[model samples]
Target: MSKKKDNLPNPFNEQPLGGLLKSIDGFFQNAFQNFQFVGGFPVYEYETETHYIIEAELPGVKKEQINLDIYSNQIKISVESSEVIEEKDDKHHVYKSSNSFQRAERYIILPFTISQKDVKASYRNGLLKIMIPNKKKRIEIE
Candidate 1:
């Protein structure tokens, strides 16, 4: 009797597996439902001796929807999206309507010493790339 009891697994009492699954579900729920997390707004940063680069994943976003503010010690990135894309056939009958706005004011703040005069930004293929040169150097890298 004792051996049989030991062999049986606790379906509702075992916590390791259940707890892990619950946490995973909560993570996604919070990230999506609140809109504030948004998977941390996935970003990558690189610093060279001459410049600093920041690349952020922003799919389905237009170039006009993005804004940036650069200060001597901090950089702020804001993305506001209010786009309504529609497609029509030759008959002028609209069948499809698309709205590409999953987030608004997705602000990213970071600290760096950068020059404002030579700041460059571009968006291509769902990615936003911004380059800021170090304040101490005016040399541009090609």
Candidate 2:
């Protein structure tokens, strides 16, 4: 009686798709590294007979962190934030700290020119409201 022993690599233990998956994951991670999740807030624009109104919803933003600029026919809004985190361990005599800063800006163009003096802005409840007087003059039919 003779016994034949065959040695073959097990296919189940080999991960053929592992490298592909890792490459795909790395590609996506690198692609999205510069993508901003909070690029800008939601803005609503409307006009009445006398004025134009703009409302922006900025959650978790402080009023002092917002800057508004009015041009002849455009409005620019800028928001900036800074955060600091520190951790200390008395027993290990270790201290760690980190700081991060973020800034976002948006621009809105108007159909007509606007006076900077007539523009008014207010922030309340994380909402920024801007009012600009309309410069268009209505003509009467003769």
Candidate 3:
């Protein structure tokens, strides 16, 4: 009988808990990969008999930090905000400060065309409201 060759030590062997740990890590990474840390506000849209209304909730956002634009068939809303924090220690003479900025944008499409001159927007108490007149033209039958 021919002698069997001895197997060398394998470095590629999986540890008992390595696979489980790796799977858990991967799950967490994928779960939070596309998560937004800021800028995902809620919006509501509805239409009345003569006009369309859109409302957006923007808590803690100042009017200066918001930008609104109305096109012939769509509306665009953008918000930008920044925060700063400071810490001071008189005894140790140490001071620290940090700043963070966040931005978010959203677009809404209208079922019908709209005129820029007929659009109105107002912001109050953390709510932004927009009104667009409905101008449906009637077609005469031949």
Q: Pick the lDDT winner.
A: 2
For all the candidates, what are their Cα RMSDs to the real structure? Answer: 12.3, 8.6, 9.5
TM-scores, each model vs. reference:
0.48, 0.69, 0.62
Per-residue accuracy of model 1 over 1-142 as CA lDDT, tens digit each: 3545466786654676776677567655643442332444677888789767888887766777677787766667776644465667878663655454454444444455556677888899979898877545457899
Error of 1 at 127 (Å): 1.0
Better of 1 and 2 by TM-score: 2
Overall local distance difference test of candidate 3: 0.78
Global CA lDDT of candidate 2, please?
0.79
Weakest lDDT window of 10 consecutive positions for candidate 2: 29-38
Name the better of 2 and 3 by lDDT.
Answer: 2
**Candidate 2 — which residues are off by over 4 angstroms?**
1-37, 139-142
**Rank by TM-score (best first):** 2, 3, 1
Cα displacement (Å) at residue 53, model 2? 0.6
| TM value for model 2 | 0.69
Score residue 51 of candidate 2 by CA lDDT: 83
Best by TM-score: 2
Instruction: Rank candidates by lDDT, best first.
Output: 2, 3, 1
lDDT of 2 by residue, 1-142 (tens): 8988778875544565665576457655644233242467788999899889999988667899899988889999988876665779999797756555677888999999887888999999988999988778889999
